[model samples]
Target: MIETVIVVLHLLVAIGLVGLVLMQQGKGAETGASFGSGASGTVFGSQGSGTFLSRVTAILATTFFLTSLGLAYYASHKASAVQEAGLPDPALQVEQVAPAPVLSEDVPVIEEDVTPVPAGEDVPPAAE
Candidate 1:
């Protein structure tokens, strides 16, 4: 349930962020003739600053970042819901794997003697 709530919040915040970004007026909205073309500074307006849309965009951006972090945390730390309720802890199960087969040091092994013979000697013929 908590995970679902977090996911919903993440989606809502993402949509809100997109809307706020799109609503903002892009740069270079002015630079055309300024009615008389004297020196109309501060392109937004005579007030020389941003408006509510910019502020809302900033707020939505922060919220989106927080929600992203929250969702990441929720995904990483979530427990496996499929585990049976009455089962023993998984930490103990490793001891129950069958032990690997053991080989005794006394077992005999056939080994070829690869020592180099004298350079000119031919190899002995195989016994029939």
Candidate 2:
């Protein structure tokens, strides 16, 4: 149950990170525009948005990394638990398949027998 929750949270954070990164304007966005037009005069002011967005992105990225590590650890632990409880380790198990049957020389093989005709005489025509 905890693993499931962590996975869901990790996915949400990843999606949010993608959206936030895309929403922020790149440094080169205002190269051709007037300085005034490029200015952000809102609550975040000129430099606040850049710093705030970057900080939030970092936090989300850290969370994503932690969740990934956690999931890996949990999976390994669960597999070990199964082994400790006497259940077979699927990776270590080998299936016993039957061997193929061997052929023997005792069985007789059929062959065609023929006699050559003498070369000088006219050969008799085969009857229909």
Candidate 3:
């Protein structure tokens, strides 16, 4: 339950960061206005330092970073829990492992002979 909440929060923060970054004007944009661009009037009244956007963006960025860390923590903790339960770790499983080779029925199986020869009996010759 907590993991799900963290995941959702992480996604929301990521989207917010993207939107905030896109909405912010580049530094070069302010330079154009300084050259007398027909006496343009901005929302901050010719720029009374609207650091509000910058502060908000910084806060959102910090939240996004924190959410990312939280998600990673939850994932690692879950993986550890699975390991403690004696089940195979899903995160450690590799899908690209090669399988053991299989032999056809035509192939002979070589095994050690376990039967002992009785006393006074002629021992059979070993196979070539």
Highest TM-score model number: 3
Question: Candidate 3: misplaced stretches above 4 Å?
Answer: 35-41, 48-50, 94-128
lDDT of 3 by residue, 16-123 (tens): 888878888888777766776743565655542347678888998899889888888888888888889999977678799788999999999999968988999999
Model 2 segments more than 4 A misplaced: 30-40, 90-128
For each candidate, what is the lDDT? 0.68, 0.84, 0.80
Error of 1 at 106 (Å): 55
- TM-scores of the models, in the given order? 0.47, 0.60, 0.62
Per-residue error for 87 in candidate 2, Å, reads 2.1
lDDT of 1 by residue, 1-128 (tens): 88788789879988988877776655554344335353346565543244767787788788888878887887655433324455565655766688898878888778977767788999877668
29-63: candidate 2 lDDT, tens digit per residue: 64533365645666776564778889999999999
Candidate 1's displacement at residue 87, Å, is 11
Model 2 global lDDT (CA atoms, 0 to 1): 0.84
* Ten contiguous residues minimizing lDDT sum, candidate 1: 30-39
Residue 102, model 2: lDDT of 77
Clashing pairs in 1: none
**Model 3 Cα displacement at 81 (Å)?**
1.0
